[model samples]
Target: MPHDWKEIQAGDEEVFKKVFDSYYQPLCLYANKILNDIDLAQDLVSECFINFWEKRTSIEIRTSFKNYLLLSVRNISLMHLRKSGEKLGNSQFVIQELEYVEDYVNELEEEKQIVRVHQAINKLPEQRRKILQLAVYNNLSYKEIATFLGISVNTVKTQMGRAYRFLKEELKDDQLTLFLLFGSNFE
Candidate 1:
C-alpha cells in the first residue's frame, strides 16, 4: 500500500515510522550512487529523515516519499562534492572506491578555506569588493556587473582584474598554510 505522507503528518507516528523504514535503505543506496561514499550516503539519508521529521507539519506529498528522499540525497551529495572540490569522473571503479570512506574532517577543512576566502574578499575596498562579489559569488559576467553597477564594461573588467590580483597575493600564503595544515590530500 502506498503511504500518504499527509496522513503521516497528521500526528501519526507509526505511519511516519513506517514511511521512514520503507524508504531508508533505498534512499541511502541512491545517495551512495551519487556520493560514492557509503557512510556519507547514510549520513545524508539520516539528515533527510531528520529534516522530514522536523518539517512534517508542512509536508506536501505530490510524488511518492521515495522520490522525495532520492532527490534530497542527490542534492546533498552534490553539495558535498562542490564543497570538497571533487572532480566528476566517468569511471565506475573509482566511484566504487569513493564509497569506502567518509572524510568529514576534510570537508570541514574545505569549509574553513571557504571562510578564509570570504574574509579575504571582505578586506578589499568597497567598490572592488562589490565587483568581485558580483563576478564570483553571484556568477555575473563583467558586462552584467557593469550594467548593475552603472559602470563601463572595460572599467568593470579592469577592477575585477585588480581584485583577482589582490586576492591572489593575499590568499597565496594562506593557501600554502592550508595545504600544510590540511595535509594537501584533498580532492
Candidate 2:
C-alpha cells in the first residue's frame, strides 16, 4: 500500500498512513511468533511505528525501509524476551511457531553451539572425522562405512567409539548438543 517511503521523508502524511496500514498487521503477526501474545505483539509493533514516526525526519536506514521496520520489531521482541527473564535455551521457551522454527534455530546461541561442534569435529583425526560423518551425518551403518572406506568393520567400530567419546567429552555441558548438531532441520 505504501507507494514510496521517500514521500514520507518529504512530509507526506498520506504516504505514512498507507505504509502503516500495509505493514502493521503483518509485522504484528511476526512479533507474535516471538512474543506468543498477540496483544503484546500489537503493542510492540505500534510502539515501534510510533517511534519511527517521531524520528522520521532524522532516521537514516542503512537497509531497505521494510528491513529497518522488521529489524526494529525483532529487536524489541528480543528485548521483551530478555526482560521477562526467560530461559532462552530451554526447549519450553524456544519458539513454537513452526514457520518461525528457522528463526529460532538460527539464534546466536544455537549458532555458537553449531560452530563449536563443527570445530570439535574438525579437530578430530581425519579418518575418525570422516567415519563419524559417514555414520552420523550420512546415516551409514558401520558395515557400510567399512566397506566404503576399505576398512574392517572392527576398525570402523573402534574409530566410531573413539569419536563418540571425544564428542561427549567436548560437549558434556551442552545438553542439546547432539540434537542441535545432527538435526536435519537446522541444516
Candidate 3:
C-alpha cells in the first residue's frame, strides 16, 4: 500500500493508523536494541507514536517515515539515558547494533514479516529454540556456544541448520528478512 505520508500531515486518520500498524514493532525492536530494557523501549516508542499522532499536522518528514520515527525513538531513548544518568551497558554495543539494523531498514517494509518470524521461531523444538536463541540473542558463534553449553560443535551446527530450514520454509516471502536479521549468527 503506497502512502502519501505528506497527506498524513493533513489529518488523515486512516493512513495514520496504517502507518502506525506498519512500523510500531520494528521501531520498538530498534529502541529495545538501544535501550536494552523492553519496558523503557516500549514506553519511549509508544510516546514517540503518541507525539507523532498529536503533532501529525506539523511533522515534516522529507525522508521515509521509517527513518523519521527511528531517529525520534533513538533520540528520545538516548535522552532518557542521559537524564536518568543510567549507564545502560556498553554504549558502543548499542550504537553498533543500531547501525546494523538501520542498514536493513530499506529491505524491511511489512511489520507482519517480523511477527511471522517470531511466531515461527517459537514453534521450533525446545533444544532447537535454545540453539537459535544462543546464536541470535547472544550473538554467539557455534563453537563458542558449543563450548559454553558443553555440547559438540556439530550439535550446535545441526540445530542451527534445522532452525534455518524451518524459518526459511515457513516464512517463504520473509526468507530474506529472516536471513538479513539472523544470517550473521547462523553463518
Candidate 4:
C-alpha cells in the first residue's frame, strides 16, 4: 500500500499529503482520459482526493489504496459527466454515453482515438455539422432545431441523418464515436 490507511485514518496530515502527492498526477490523467477535458479532470481528481481524506475514518478499503483511489476518480468523473449532461439538456448523448463510454475507456486508452474522433466530427459538412451540434451539443430537438435554423423538421432530420452517416463512415475504424453517434436510432 502506497498509503498507510490506518495512519491516514488517524488524521495524520503528513501521510495524507504523501498519498496526495503520490497519486495526484496519475489520477488527473485518468480523469482526463474519461472526460476529455483537462481542466475538469484536474478539478475532479482534486475533489476526489479531498473527499477520500474527509471520509477516511468511515471508509472501508478492501482493495489496494491505488485501486480504491482510481475507482473513486472514475466514479466521480462519470458522475460529473452525467450531472453536467442533465443540467445542459439531458439529451441523447448523455444517455448513450452512460451506456457506452465505460466500454471505450476499458478498451482504448490511447490519446489518438480522441484526436481521431474530433477530426472525423470536424470533417462533417457545414449544415449537417450544425444540425448535429444543435442536437447533440445543445440538446435541441428536431422541432427546436428546425425552428432555430428556419427549416422544416424533415429537413433537419435529413441533415442530421447525413451528418451521422458521414461521421459513421469517417469513424468506422474507431468505436469512440459509438457513444456520440449511436442511440439516435440512426443504425
Q: Give me the displacement of residue 43 in model 2, in angstroms.
A: 0.2
Best by lDDT: 3
| Order by lDDT, highest first | 3, 2, 4, 1
Clashes of each: 1, 0, 0, 0
Q: In candidate 4, which residue pairs clash?
A: none
Model 2 vs. true fold: TM: 0.46
Query: Global lDDT of each model?
Result: 0.69, 0.77, 0.80, 0.74
- Any runs in candidate 4 off by more than 4 Å, and if so which? 86-187
What are the RMSDs of all candidates, in order? 17.6, 15.3, 12.3, 17.4
Which of the predicted structures, 1 or 2, would earn the higher lDDT when compared with the native? Answer: 2
How do the residues 1-187 of candidate 2 rate in per-residue lDDT, one tens digit apiece?
1236678877788888878886787778778877879999999999998898888889888876776877788778888988999644434443344235334433634667788899889989999999999988899998999999999999998998888778778877664676556554222
The residue pairs found clashing in candidate 1 are 36-99
Candidate 1 per-residue lDDT over residues 1-187, each given as its tens digit: 2335666677688877877776677667667777779999899889988888888888776755555665566667778888899975555643443333223323544676778877877899999999877876687888999999999999987887787777667777465543443233210
Report the error of model 4 at residue 54, Å. Answer: 0.9
Candidate of highest TM-score:
3
Q: What TM-score fits each model?
A: 0.44, 0.46, 0.52, 0.45
